[model samples]
Target: MAFNYRRIIVKIGSNVITQANGLPDLQRLEKLVDQIAAIKKSGTEVILVSSGAVASGRSLITVSDKNDSVATRQLLASIGQVKLINTYSHLFEQFSILCSQVLVTKEDFRDRLHYLNMKNCLEILLQHQVVPVINENDVVSVTELMFTDNDELAGLIASMLNAQALIILTNVNGIYNGDTKLPGSAIIKEVTAAGIDFSSFVSTGRSQFGRGGMITKSTIAQKTAKLGIAVHIANGTADNILLDVLAGNVTHTRFVPNKKASGKKKWIAHSENAATGAVQVNEGAKLVLTSTKASSLLPVGVVAILAEFKKGDIVKIIDERNKLIGLGLAEYSSDKAREWAGQKNQRPLVHYDYLYLQG
Candidate 1:
């Protein structure tokens, strides 16, 4: 069987790693490690985004009065992360495959500099033939900085690395047309640009030790696919599921990419931080930015300023109709733009390299 991708991000949910008693399953971990090592031996690059820290931590603790509170979970994560990485390291080492652990919080991606640093680090690891095992830093993450789940994190990583595909290993075979437990519910073979409605099959029950359900996975699939990365949702518990899915020999749900955005454009468009201010422009300015390959936002076209911002800060560019046309890094601050607007000799408000036109 022909493998579909050269580089891939494989995300294993907590349910796939935890047993009925809410403990990490050693056998399951071994199987996953073996499969990943096998793929690496075949000369394919793999990044693993895994979840199971809190669950594994819970198993280590004998007794606790705290009842699954955030603080308690954080404490558990602090204890479990070591165990998780140790297990992964030892298992992969058996096959002479080296692995590194990377723990990230949402704040890491909020800043462009830090985000780029992380991307560079992962790339370096791949160059050394080391698989980077990533997990969220649950110990320090607050509500706002916390990713909804590993599924969202996986999507972000895939987009960051420009991976060809993101494979989300879950408990179910794939998304179902109807209720998964219903007699006639069938698996969705493929999901093209036109998204499928699997709302009926979505469940509110969180995994035995995980936070998200199929709903979260579906949201991740759709979001990542928009960035031109194919997303596959398949059963992680099934024997040889990872190999079969990668080899295109399994019945799994695949979300195809729509209009693929360039890597730089995707980064600019999806930056975690919002624009610092707004630049109101006439229709002509909007047309020039959207249609022409202009290198700068000419000052003569700027009509108004809605807020104050500094140079180098991201800002929204709006048309005369008040519709947001795109986001760009301001060449001039709001105060400067105000002074320069309508001036015949003033420089551009934002350079083309710093701008991203929205679709």
Candidate 2:
């Protein structure tokens, strides 16, 4: 494949930007900015999803007064987010690049309207030739996160903004096929199949100074690939890594996207965090929903109500076998839905306008 990416989302994790001292590493940050500047000079629109605010904040305060607690983390993030963005702004400005800081919470994309608005804001920034450096609003969002990680955010932004590629920069070389400690272990160069499982080779451990692991990056890569966007998971420390990956001269894990899925289908099927409830349907309904020219889900096909949800909530539409067929905003409450289950006639459970089948 040729490097024809026009718009790209680059995710820089905490470890990639922060040193072991829990502070922003200038050398690494400078190299990264230089690469991104080079990419911008090539006429590519770039969005950065960064994750070093809290880690940088950790070292800002005294080590003797450390709690390593969530509350303290929130406080540190409040302090460090400013510093992190300021540093990014200065570096980008040196290269004549305009940068803007945007703090987002997972709540921003909880609904269709909200998500579209967020999309519009990003579109405006890109149109005006400003690079938006986004980070999760860690201080404000406590109960629910706006993104699972920067990896997930990058995937969402790549898909949401109709980006051509997503490059996730992490500490590792890429997804390894065997024990990362062993000598013979190798990186999986490419993943092309839909629903290709990589859990067996993944570890549950998270990275230091970062919330997500390699497995999390891999999962995000797979989900974004379904939307016809290429995903690259590569080592951030490697020299000219970004340029090399674009040139296809580097050893990195690449996810080749399927070109069949539409934009709406991608927004639904890959919305792992935005969904709210579950609605189980029988065999007849499952077949119809997955078939070509799918009609609205009628009341007669619903087999069970697995969760209590209100109308307009994005619920998971599952088959009797517990296979997820699609996601749709509910038109009825859980009580009304259960009462109308298997009935001959009723309003469409989920209208065609909102229903999105799995890719």
Candidate 3:
């Protein structure tokens, strides 16, 4: 069968990789590894963002009552990461496919330099025909710096690499119109730029073993798709889920891609969290920026500089009510931007090429 995408990100959620008792499900992992190996042999580059370290860690050690939740997690992640990566390494070894373990925290992508460095490292691994098995460095990531879940990390990786698609394997078949347990609730097969409000039907409940829920997946999927990467959410436990997704033989929710976005824009799309500065723009600027016509953020349209940042830092654009408008790379220091705010004919604070508007 012909594969649809030459490059893809596969994110396996904790719920899909762990058993009911919160232990690593080795049998299920082996099956998924077999499928990934087959996909790699078919000439497609695969980057895996997997979750199961905590579950794997839980199996190896029991925490004392004196340890708090954070301490417990750190201990588990420190120990479990080794077990999880080793399982992946051993499984891929059977097929003569080499895999590398990549652990990262939100801090890794906080700045442009760090982001590019990580990207370069992954590129080298792929060039050497090594599958990169990535996971969050839970041992070091505090609650404030943690990604919403592996789904968010996967989206970032997909956008960073300009992947053709992102396939998120969860416990559920796909996003549904109502509670999944209800008999009549149907899966929403495809999502486009139609501005559908998923919150009306999708539940906000977290997964049994994961931090995020369907809401987080849908949000990240939409953002990733807007950056020109198609996204698929499907059941990881299904037979040959990865292969079926690539072959168009699976039932899942797909977020259609825009396909016209530039690589820089894709990177900017995910930089909202990495932004260090904030600027509130006038309504006039917001309207033009969000319009079909491309426009740069001019100093004349800026109302206030809300934070201090260097010229090259990523900044958040807000509206009169302090609502986020988008994220962009600043062309000047916040001090300079403030001096020129509402002034005429100043250099654009953020050029259209580096700006990513939000909905």
Candidate 4:
């Protein structure tokens, strides 16, 4: 099939690879891997964000009350990660394709420097034709230190890599407008910035082995699409679903790309959840930050500082009314910002290269 997107991010959810027995579904996994290989042979570059380690580990290790705890969950992820990646490596070998395992934590993307470094690493892999099979480092992840789910991770990667589209493979065919079992219910094929409110049909409940659900998927889809990348949520079990969707022969929920964003804006927008503090700017400051076209948030514009953050941390830029207007890396500590607030002769709070305004 002639797919439109040359570079794609494909997310394989835990439910897609987990069986009713709480173990990895080898047959299903093998089939999905085959489809990925087929797509790659068709001249498409693919990055796989896979989740199933914790589910697979449960079958190998006995579970108890303690197993439900965060520490135990991390142990399970560590144990199954090896087996999961090995299985993927073996399958891809049959197609003569090489793949590498990449494990990461939310901390890696929290810093702009590390974020760019990661992009460099992935770009090098793609240049050499090696597929990057990535998974969250659940071994050390807990609470806010974790991603909402792999869908959120995939969206971040899609935007970071400047991929044309992201394909989220889940158990469901797509997002439906009503009860899926009902005769009239159907998949909503497309959504955009001006789309209807589909949240009414979304269920907050997550999958048995995953942390996110339809709501999270839809939300991430819209967010990534707004940064000028398309997103598709489709059933992984369907025959050649990946190929079909790319060929425009499938019925999947598609989030069409909005106006394109500069590479820097995409980074800032996706970094919303990573904010470490806030800088309260006055009317003059807000205008200076947003209208300068390319200028730093001068210390003279700061009216207040909220929360404690060290230099080089991501901070939200708010107005005097406490409305969030932008985000950027603070060059000064919160204490420094407090000391320099309303002072015209002080250094800039945040440089222009690191600032991103909200729409």
Considering summed lDDT, which 10 consecutive residues are worst modelled in model 4?
59-68
Q: Once model 1 is optimally superposed onto the true structure by TM-score, how far is the C-alpha of residue 84 displaced, in angstroms?
A: 0.2
RMSD in Å for candidate 2, one decimal? 2.3
* Candidate 2 vs 3: which has more lDDT: 3
Tens-digit lDDT track for model 4 on 1-359? Answer: 34588899999999999997789998998998998999999889999999998876776787678446887888889888988988899999999999999898888888779899999999999999989999999999898889999998999899999999999999999999987878898899989778656678776778888899898999889889988899999998787888888988988899989887778777877787889898888898777677837778998888778888899888999897888898888887999899888998788888777777775
What value does the lDDT take at residue 29 in candidate 2? 88
| lDDT string, candidate 2, 72-137, tens digits | 778889988988888899999998889999888878878878888988999999999999999988
Please give the clash total of every predicted structure, in order: 0, 2, 0, 0
lDDT by residue for model 3 over 238-341, one digit each (tens)? Answer: 98998898888988899988756876777788877789999999999999999999899999999988988898899999999989989999999999999999
User: Clashing pairs in model 1?
Assistant: none
RMSD of 4: 2.8
Q: In candidate 3, how many Å is residue 338 off? A: 1.0
Residue 124 local lDDT, model 4: 96
- TM-scores for every candidate against the unseen true structure: 0.84, 0.92, 0.98, 0.89
Q: Could you tell which candidate, 2 or 4, scores higher by TM-score?
A: 2
**Candidate with best TM-score:** 3
TM-score, structure 3 vs. true: 0.98
Which lDDT value does model 4 have at 196? 59
Model 1, which residues run further than 4 Å from truth?
A: 196-205, 273-308, 315-328, 336-359
What C-alpha RMSD separates each model from the true structure? Answer: 3.6, 2.3, 1.2, 2.8
